[model samples]
Target chain A: MNPERMYDALDRITRVRGVRGAMVVSAEDGLVVGEAVMEGVRGNAVAALAASLAARLGRAAGAAEAGAQRFVHLQAEVGAMLLMPGADGLVIVAVTDQHVNVGLVRLEMQRMVEDIA
Target chain B: MKARVVEPWLLAPVERFVRESGARLTMVMTPSGQVLAQYGFTRAVDVMSAAALGAGIAASTGEIVRMLDEPDFRVLNHQSAQHGIFLGRFDSRRGPLLGLVVYGEDTSIGLVQLFFEDFVADLEEAAPAETPRGPVLAADFERDLNESLATLFR
Candidate 1:
């Protein structure tokens, strides 16, 4: 995986308005390899949960004949999570508020994944 | 957690979402990681893991909101060279439901979004969610974890 490019992608996500934090995680085994965050956001916890979710969903997706799991996003009353598979076993996760522009985030994340994968 | 066959009326739309979106897999589950209905998952363990993680992230985000006093986040989307995924929540009479879609080179995120909205509407109408359940007990967690691990290996 391209470490430099990963940092760049994470930087862009963190810069978005309402985004609390972002991290690069290992999809195979839940772990955060790299991260960036704004105040009040816990990068470690986000990475662990995001990575686990992606991994879990990836397996289900595979069984359902859905092919390889690619992207994951979670929305709630309070916030949201965006996860993208990166180079090797790495997955990128971003935490954002309700107001964040999802279209723009997806577009950038798409490019970032391409660069790192 | 448990798995249910998302109401029969909702199957048509769910099927349509996969067929039209060219998505390989899709899942409608609870925030706490319980599978309501799933497409393309061959193993139960995988579904178990997905639901747990999806719900875990949602729950963890809630923690962030409690600490910061800001509104919670919404809508999460991710993409890779070969696949794309989208996760979102919508309320039903039952409560809140999480929708997850995974697509590959054959489709785009825009297409997935289009179908996901349709699926959500159908889901709400057919499966009016019940009141949310309480937290999973510690003992249940351990038992569930062991079961999922065994399934993953097999």
Candidate 2:
């Protein structure tokens, strides 16, 4: 995968409100195919973890009758993680601070997922 | 390794999930990447690799959310030419369990996601009520692996 192109997409998301980091990951192996992550946070780990959580949540969505699970937003007390499908069996994971404008970030990422693909 | 004592009850939901979703294979593991129950994987190493990667990805993403002051990310879907994959979590009285599924033309992600919710709820009800949620012991890894393999292979 092209890290530069992935970085460009991630870079745009990171510019959004409360966005901290972003990366492209392989869903199959939980490895970082590319990243535009920031300091103090491990992008590799994020890619790997997001891969697992996304898979599990996808399964959960399936079992729950939630449908394709194209997008996932995990809200925690601290912040949130958002995942979207990208080109070629890849996922885009974004980290944002609590109270971030989630709606806007999601919209931007949604576009980015397509753009990157 | 994701370690835990093997219980017979865990298999029920897993089996149901496979049949209900028309998955070619299914694996129920831990957040730490240990296979608690698996169906469709031909090799033990495949399970091990998947579990490890699953656990690592879960941990990493969970931490990222926490770092950004968020709580969690719930589900993920992957599509390709040959097949599709679904992964997510379920809570039992014992602890949280991870599920991985692979399906081909026989099923779609929507069907799998729809059924996954029911599987989790059923699993929650079926889990032994007395077992408090906590970490699995490392010492039991080998024994747990052996027992689970024995059951699957049988």
Candidate 3:
């Protein structure tokens, strides 16, 4: 996808309340394809960690005959991470605070993935 | 795989990095091409060749960055379908150290880079105070190189 469109997608995701950042990352190598993050967020680190987790989860799912992973949510004490696997080895990742509206965020991310596909 | 280091202090950090990063091959050397530690290389010739090429790439790229008047790049990566190579530079008590890592599809560059930060920190903490050595003379160059290689492979 074009850079502008990629950013637009991320912008829409980050527009949701409590989302610190959003990124399009390569699941294979954890490299950032595009991102829209706040000033203090570490986009590179988040992209890397998200890709790693997605790959591991995908493998685990395959091993268990569970088919492909549709979504991943990791909740921590202070914040949360949400991942939506997309076509062509791409993943849409969103970092959010604990108060984030998970339902809305997931809905928007699903839309973004469909758009990319 | 086990990592062998010429300097004792490098052993723990290099070994940890090797295990954590899942790198198929790795080498730690000075910017001038002196090998300090290595993992997963069976042949001495391959080690020396990789060291030479890695140092050369770092030097040439550093010069290119200088020409552009840009800040030095922290890490350089090249990825293909099945494997990736990561070259990073870190500052230690002795001086600048370069790390070259080759990883397969089992691991990604992001994981390697993420662990490399911890490796650098461990190395910095473990490195002993610098002890100056006499400049390498033409006659001693070959002997020193062979000895270092022997230490690594032995």
DockQ metric for all predictions: 0.03, 0.03, 0.69
lDDT of 1: 0.71
Tell the DockQ for candidate 2: 0.03
lDDT of 3 by residue, A27-86 (tens): 988878889999998887888889989999999999999998999999999999999999
Among these predictions, the greatest lDDT belongs to 3
Worst 10 residues of 3 chain B by lDDT: B136-145
lDDT, model 2: 0.74
Better of 1 and 3 by TM-score: 3
Stretches of candidate 2 off by over 4 Å are: A1-117, B1-6, B132-138
For candidate 1, lDDT tens digit of each residue in B23-124? 787777667665657777777767777777777767776688668987664567777777777777777666777877778755555456656666777676
Give TM-scores of the second chain, every candidate. 0.73, 0.81, 0.95
Clashing pairs in 3: none
Worst 10 residues of 1 chain B by lDDT: B1-10
**Lowest lDDT 10-mer window, candidate 2 chain B?**
B1-10
Per-candidate TM equals: 0.46, 0.51, 0.91
Indicate which candidate wins on TM-score: 3
Error of 2 at B114 (Å): 0.3
